[model samples]
Target: MSATPPPTSSPELKRVVTGALVGTALEWYDFFIYGTAAALVFNRLFFTDSDPAAGTIAAFATFGVGFVVRPFGGVLFGHLGDKIGRRSTLIITTLIMGVSTGLIGLLPTHPAIGVWAPILLTLLRVCQGLGAGAEFGGAATLLAEHAPPGRRGYYASFAQTGVQIGLVLGTSAFLLVQLLPEEDFLAWGWRLPFLVSFALIGVALYVRLRVAESPVFREMERTREIVRLPIKDALARHPRNFLVGVGAHINDTAIVYTLSTFSVAYATAELGMSNHGALFGVILFALTVIVLQPVYGNLSDRVGRRPLNLFSVVFVALFVYPYFLMVDTGVPWLVWLAMMIMGAFGFAPQVAVQPVFYAELFGARVRYTGFAASRELGAALAGFSPLIGAALAARLDGAPWLVAAFLIGTAVISFVAFYASRETKDIDIADIADIDIAGIDPVRKPVAEE
Candidate 1:
């Protein structure tokens, strides 16, 4: 019942992939700097209550706020992505993210604004969550649809690569500002990273404005196959994929925040490590992930996505305890090594293969809604990971066993999800009938089309 996509030329595919990469990289850079600020600056600047531990948890709670509202963003933007087109939806998302980030750089702190400070920060974070909700999903979908059937994994991985680049840029911006005196860093330098978004917004706009629409979506439009309520249709028609995508996302979402945001706060608070050192570990970890994304992605293209997904969760489950042990050693080199090892095998492979894997779970009609909502829901559920890590560590008097156990539990969830889901690397994404969704009904069409 699906229309065939127009044949995509190689040059167009490359152009789209490049745009997705540059645009996502810039957007995610905004997301990551906020994480860094939560770890280092927000607690002191915005949530200036007593109790250092409580303040840290409060800061991370605001960080989690961005994740909690993501499903709403998913629904709103996913509708636009499925209804209008992927290209325009991505451009809107980038605009939302970039503008919100730039505003954060100019916000007044608690000392100047009192209670209004945290309130405004929370409000701005909601804006970020909304924009971010669909950024990755739309980028991945666009890349997957443009990609040749055999190379979807390899190409879609670029979306994730852009995310790592953003992490590098976000962390690197903080690192540069760290060269300032501590007083200067706390006063004005912290704002510099967020302010860079002003510049990045332009670059993102330039790239995204040039990207082509998904050919699969074009075919859907040409044949009037657009869905009216895509989220409802996705849930009713492809419940299994909806659930699999949700469960499959928990491990990476929780672990990445735990490793990047929580671990930074943990090291500075408990291990007596300098903020510079802990942030350096994240940079190293991100660099490792950036390097291995394409390697794992290309491998998934050859061997299939399931194996890498399974291996990643299992490795992460087993490695969490050892990971904590290495970090607790308080040795800078060992900490960097711990981050890299986990980032390499534990996080990168699954994440690299994830976009294409999720992309193939539904037909193009529901792909944006299903992927963004399900994945972001998992993220919402785990969004409090850094807060949880802080609370658990405080409860245990700085011991990390409880947090380790929590991560292992998340890993188990994803392992079961990967086991239940079918391999999708070889599937034709445009063929609604051939996708691996359960109880997929092909005759259902949108009540209205754009």
Candidate 2:
């Protein structure tokens, strides 16, 4: 392997990272607003015919529907991303997600339009899934491919940070709307969060359109390294890496859904907490991730991605039960503390490193497809975690132990995958596609000679 790095000037790096971050934030903002609504408003608004518990389950099922369509999104956009360019695919995805989310604001309720309300809501959610499927993988790929060597984790962390910022914005919007009179909040306030996505999409487009395509992708095309069928190439050549990516990502998705979406519904409907208290706790914890994620990502550059990933799953396994134990106490401080620890400390570190971590597993030819396909497949399973948790709790007479056990099981799956994977934090970007497993060293490599 040549001890030379890919071309990534500082000025280009800044512009690319900023574009990735802003675009990711907007896409996730649109996506998360649906999750928040499914928990707080959709059950009552769209699924009015069912009893309360059943209604919540149905609503969360719709939320999961978005995830179900993500792999297809990844397949569709990843192909375009590999064949055409990341910048263009991302532009189209932003429009799809933003327009779909905004249209959701205009959807009628069950009382007004009957079953069509939920059906239309589900269709919009699918559009969200389709766009999001390609959104993160492409953004992460763009940022990682443009980042300075030895700092991929630090730079790519910005994409995950954008995701947390989106959650914060979505939850905060709900919190603001919840302050209105209950009837009014239910009638129209729920639409505000979805409608605001139109403006966010505009800002994302402005920044994203100006940023250049990933330097690495341009290099790949120049060298004729772009494959005709990237997903097929990825699965055929790097099957182990693809499987590892799926296994390694599940805990992050499951845990986040449990805390941000499921916990809100569980707190409000089951635990008898006010919506404001539940949303406040989530918003507070999500805000901490914006700070903690980048720090952990930077740390991974020095310490290696494996140790932190292992620590994340282990932490989730040991703490999942206690996290809920704290939530059940009904003290706002205790709930917030648990959320902070679980989200900021446990989950943040895993995701902070994941974008680059997964991206590094494949060669440039199939990185986008490999990353998106594997990650979204994992997300599909974890997306229904809230509904699963609710069903488990409902079946067990409102006890959360069954749900906690399910989370621990997911952690174990991720832990084994992380344990088996080779660390790539220090691998040269040019060599990563073809680097053998035996060639990978967990310790940082010597810096390439200038």
Candidate 3:
């Protein structure tokens, strides 16, 4: 076995977890602001030429464009992360996302810039996508590598929990902005949230700079186990594991987008509810996620990740139809209840453990690349979910049945992927090289015995 560094200090572990939490929170806050804007304002602001339905489709398409560029970002930064170090890659991604988001707040509307408005918007969205592509994987990998053996799931989950906090901040920001008059809101009020994101960047940078580098990566460098091309090594050496990570990741992105982004448009535009009401529902659900994700992650350390993940996917598949039914009622209480059930209960478990689950799939040499590349590739399927949901609703005479079915299909794909993969909760990070990429071993036993 390679000589792993001594365990991270207690205070240092706290600092590292705090940095991961703060940095990801700020980055996702920027990302989520765009999603909120795409649903609430972008169609009218950027795609004015099309009818309302067509405009929403176009706007959400731009949202998906970010996802399109994410895999590239993952490959680019994942390589740097694997080669150089996690700390530096994180700082670079933070600056890229922060700058792109701040610039978006300053962009002129279609009426002012004509065609250039959307062209610039798409370009900036690409930058945002690239930045986001590396954030989760990097954060998760860093935290998992730092965490103590039995508590990796709990520590790694803080990254995603921070993301949920970002969702709450972003949704709440929009809710506050939604209070303005309709004319002013459509004109200038919507830019406030994006503009405020600049301050968050400063705070995130401060926290991130304070944290030490991942001990696992340092040990790799000390032991000279670092690979030349992490992406190539990950693919060539671990194809099955990479594919498994991709399949396991699809539903996490798809399900979240369906519940949060598309449902915002579905509730407001199609159901005739107010944006305030929808944003409120989103805020409530996000708050629930912040509280539950860690609990679920901690639970996974005891019960195992596969059962929780499988249960969550199956639960979402079953609940999505009724979830939409509640939304269509135009009653705020029912919608809130439905979102709480879906987000806090059904969705939280998968998301809670996903970071650790993917990070655990690879050995130290290619962990960053394997986790980032595969997860973002899966994100490509999810990136267009809101756009697809919009189209499905339009095609079905404004009903959400087809959209719900599509969500169920994605869930099943993820379930199958998780079912086929082996559990890694008990695997030692230092000894991971003893296991093959396909999760097979002649001597070492599987973590979870059936």
Please provide, for model 1 over 56-142, each residue's C-alpha lDDT reduced to its tens digit, 9 standing for 90 to 100.
Answer: 899999999999999999989999999999999999999899999999999999999999999999999999999999999999999
- How does candidate 3 fare on TM-score? 0.96
Q: Roughly what TM-score does model 2 have, to 2 decimal places? A: 0.95
The 10-residue segment with the lowest total lDDT in model 2: 441-450
> On residues 1-450, what C-alpha lDDT tens digit does candidate 3 reach at each position?
266578999999999999999999989999988988998899999999999999999999999999999999999999999999988899999999999999999999999999999999999999999999999999999999999989999999999998998898888888988889999888899999989878878998999999999998998888787888998888876677788888887887887777678999989887888888888998888888889988999998998888899999999888989998998898999999999989876779999999899887777788888889999999987789999999999999888999989988899989998997778788776656523544476124356521
Candidate 2, residues 249-299, lDDT tens digits: the string is 899999888888888888877778888899888888888888887899899
Off by over 4 Å in 1: 434-450
The TM-scores of all predictions, comma-separated, are 0.96, 0.95, 0.96
* Better TM-score candidate (2, 3): 3
CA-only RMSD, every prediction: 2.8, 3.0, 2.8
How far residue 310's Cα lies from its native spot in candidate 3, in Å, is 0.8
Question: Which 10 residues in a row give candidate 3 its minimum summed lDDT?
Answer: 441-450
